[model samples]
Target chain A: MESTYLFLTTVTIQSSMAVLFATLGEIVTEKSGILNLGVEGMMLMGAMSSFAASLYFKNPWLGVTCGLITGAFFALIHAFFTIGLKANQVICGLSLTIFGMGLSSFLGRFLIGKTGTRFLIWHVPILNKIPLVGPILFNQTPLVYLSYIFVPLIWVLLYKTNIGLSLRAVGENPTAADVTGISVVRYRYLATIFGGMMAGLGGSYLSLFYTPGWKENMTAGQGWIAIAMVIFSTWNPFRAVIGSLMFGGINALQYYFQASGITIIPNYILMMLPYIFTLVVLFLINQTEGAKRKLGAPASLGVAFEREL
Target chain B: MIEIKVKQRIAYPKITKFFTPFFALFFALLFGAGLFKWVGVDPLKAYKIMLSGAFGNFYNFSEVIVRGIPLILSGLSVGLAAKMMLWNIGCEGQIVMGGVGATAIALFASPYLPNYLVIPAMIFSGFIAGALWIFIPAIFKAKWNVSEIISTLMLNYIAIIWMEHLYFGPWRDPEGRGFPGSAIFPDAAWFPRYLGTRIHLGIFIVFIVTILIYILLNFTKLGYEIKVIGESELAARYANIKVTRNIFIVLMISGGIAGLAGVGEVAGVYHRLQQGLSSGYGYAGIIVAWLGRLNPWGILSVGIIFAGFMVGGDALQLNLQLPSSLSLVLEGALLFLVLAGEILPKYKISISWKKLSKS
Candidate 1:
């Protein structure tokens, strides 16, 4: 029973890491007031590029870099169109997703069913020796550890820094930020690129650590779940941990049910829990006025910023 | 150093709007050439092959029409919703449920119904199923002002999962050699087709719906209210337009249209509910809707051309040994380029290079 308990806790953390990274990334992006709906596509591209690059270079770290670069590249396209060209953010973001998905599928065809360099489980010496908490947290891929650091790091970056203040100001009121000498365009571009890198890192975690291979649509709506998590957490990085864990818990539950020979609930229904939960979360957030006020979306979210000339 | 400046246009030309898509296509082709070259395929040859493959013969053209049927419907679905600035991203799920609805009737109730009633009943059920699928998100958006985009998108995942469950579990054909789908739909459920080609009655359905939607959006009171709401909800409210009710109505119609696309696949083309029914038609519809600029006529034309791209893409897979997702890449690129081009009419942009003077 202790073993099962340990297994579930570890699996929950392991499964949630990808989404956790993406949620934190999107939190930053959305905080800059740009609603990028292309996380799924960026993640796919990142996964495919990282897997292929790692396979070629035979180095997991290089693959990780490739993933991050590819994600940033895709996000750059979105930024160019939505931020630079002043196009509709939603349409540009959706196009990025479609383009990313298609490009990844086109490029990654050769990588199908092929294994590459992957991050193996590394246990920290002193940390792994602790009680039940130690093994579950300490024994994970480097990406998982990165996710753990990112949650607090992003929280600090968003809440405790002047840069975060500028970023939030840009998202909330770009005109006001522009008046204050903050470059709305630069802040938005950086925030978007950083978000993309995080999403890419999340995708890398899946290809390198979790599933350990490249597949079409491999992220399997986790990117979208991450987007929903950004909302579920009310755009706060710390609360994003709860949202990601909840998704991870759902995934672990599905895994456990299948492994335990449980037939009471159908497999597809179990698969649907995350998406259904997202809708429920959105509904709850919408219905609760207090939650809405405290954790409302940035005023400029999804609206392209254009300074009056 | 280079300095760039942008100024809003005082008078945007109608002619520019007409030509923007063409220019965007030209740019996308130029960009696609680079992608093709990188992938080691000759761009000219690829383009030639695609053009010929799509418009090669009468049969091929008919196939393009067949592919366009769902695209046009789903495009119309998305376009109608976009008229009110609502993103019905869940059209994919709505399409699946439409197939499920049609399949349920085809498998269970066809034997009890008259031949004439089967098709209409299937159509109605399919439409209702799609509407019902989106109704939850619509109500939420109307009542509590939820983001329809995310909610609809989430429902899309649920709808597809539900459809898979139906085919793989409860509705699996008993004597079908353990295949993961329902039994073949009855003849009564099958839609009428042209004599030699795979083209079915869906083309006519798409045509009528397009015209009807055009008329509705341009001529009706509800259409005027939708346009007003799309412009500004605050203005809409002040003008006494029931914004909430209109949103619900528009989404219901949008989902119903997308559902019709699913019905076409099962009843008109496949004659059975099966895997690969959704196959990105709903997502493709978004590109079509946007490329068409949410106009019914534009959607019809763009939907056909995009369908040709898909047919041509199949050719690439066959002869060039390229992944069929090439069409998706082109579609995405085209949409992106067009989205960028959208700024042209609104603003005049200028770039100049400058030399730094020595101090």
Candidate 2:
């Protein structure tokens, strides 16, 4: 029972970091009132690029940096589209996603079955002696600890600072914010690029620490799960962490359940849980009368701000 | 630092419309060539091979049509919904369900029923199944104002999983050889072909769907109402058009048509219900719809062009050892460039005079 507990805990946190990073990134972007639906695309680009880069550079950290750039690069196109061209955000985002998927698949062709330099495991020096919690909580990769710090750091950044307030103001009421001297375009671009970069890191995590081998669409629906996590958390960075862990637990539970030899429920049906859970939660939150969703959603989330020059 | 301003065009020259698509195509090809170069393949050689493979001979044209048949249905599904401003990215899900429906009819009812009844029944069941798949998302969008984007996207994953559950469990072939696919469909259920080629009766079906969509969008009140709704939902309500009902109808039409693509694939192409039934036709349909600008004839043309990409991509795999995913890259580049180019005709750009003062 103790072993099972440790197994589930370690797996949960490991899986959670990828989604946690993505959700946090999206939260920041949405806070600035830019809705980016290209998380999956950006993540895929990040995953493939980082894996390939790590393979070439022989350093997982450098590969992760490359992923950050690649993800931001994809988001740059999206930024140019919605911010510069004033194109419909939904269409441009969808295009960005498809572009990412295609590019990743095309580029990842030779990288299949290839492993890369991975984030090394570490245990807290003195904390490693603690009972059940020690192995689960204190013993983890560096990135996992970084993800733990991000929750509070982002929470404070989003809630405590003037920049956060201005970002929120821009997303909530761009015209009013514009009158008050905040540049909506700049804030949105920065927020979106940051979001894209985090999503890339999320993908980099998948390639470098979580799985450490490249395959076609290795990120699968995790990017979507991260997006769903953003909504499920009601745009709170801390809440987003909890949501990611929950979804991550569910993902890890699938493997656990399979290994335990449960015969009644099949694998494919188990696979449906995450998506169905997302749908149910989205429906519940978006019922229009839900107070939580109302408070969390940016006022002008997907609306294009056409500045009068 | 020069500032740019956009002015909405009141009226555009007819010639500009004709040139925009060609320009988009030219740029898309250029972008694709650059991608090829990055992948260590010669751009000119790859393009030459691709063009030849896609349009080399009568056999290649037939293959293109075979591949295009589903894309037309998938494109129309999206094109119709896009007209009503309903973003139905669930065409992939709808297609999968349609395949299930058609496969059930083909496998179960084909032997029991007359040949004439079976084919039509499969088609009808496929449409109904597809429509049913999108029903919940439609209601949520119409009544509750839920974002159909995530809902529809989620449904795609669910549908694929559901399909996998069946094939891997109950639907797995038991008799002939312990395969993953269902039993080969009965002869009576097969889509008829012409001139000993793989091109099925879907050729005629494609033409019919294209004509119907064109007429529906161009000559019908529903089409006009869809246009109004897309342009402005408040304006549509003011015009006394039933926004909720139109929303539902649009979804049903979109889902039903997309399902037919599944039917064409199963009854025509694969001849069985199995894994890999949808090769991203659902998602690719969106690209086709956008590429075609929601025009029926344009959808048909774009469908064929995309189909050519698929066929040529296969040829690339066989001959040059290039990955089939190159086609996906090409498609993405085309969609991106086309989307960029689409703005030019509608809006005019001008240089701001007092750029220095603004800074």
User: What DockQ do you compute for every candidate structure?
Assistant: 0.80, 0.64
Candidate 1, residue A43: Cα displacement in angstroms equals 0.6
A1-309 in candidate 1: lDDT tens per residue?
998798789999988988998888899999999989999999999999999999999999999999999999988888888788878888888888889889989889999999888999888999998998999999888888877778888889988999999999999999999999999999999999999999998998889889999888999888888888888899888889998898898889898889988878888989999899888988887777456656757989989897887
Error of 1 at B105 (Å): 0.7
Q: Tell me how far the alpha carbon of residue B285 in candidate 2 is from the true structure, in angstroms, after superposition.
A: 0.6
- Residue pairs clashing, model 2: none
For residues A234-264, write the lDDT of model 2, one tens digit per residue.
8899889778887778777887888888656
lDDT of 1 by residue, B172-236 (tens): 88877877778999899999999688898888889989999999999999989989998899999
Clashing pairs in 1: none
Alpha-carbon error at A271 in model 1, in Å?
1.3
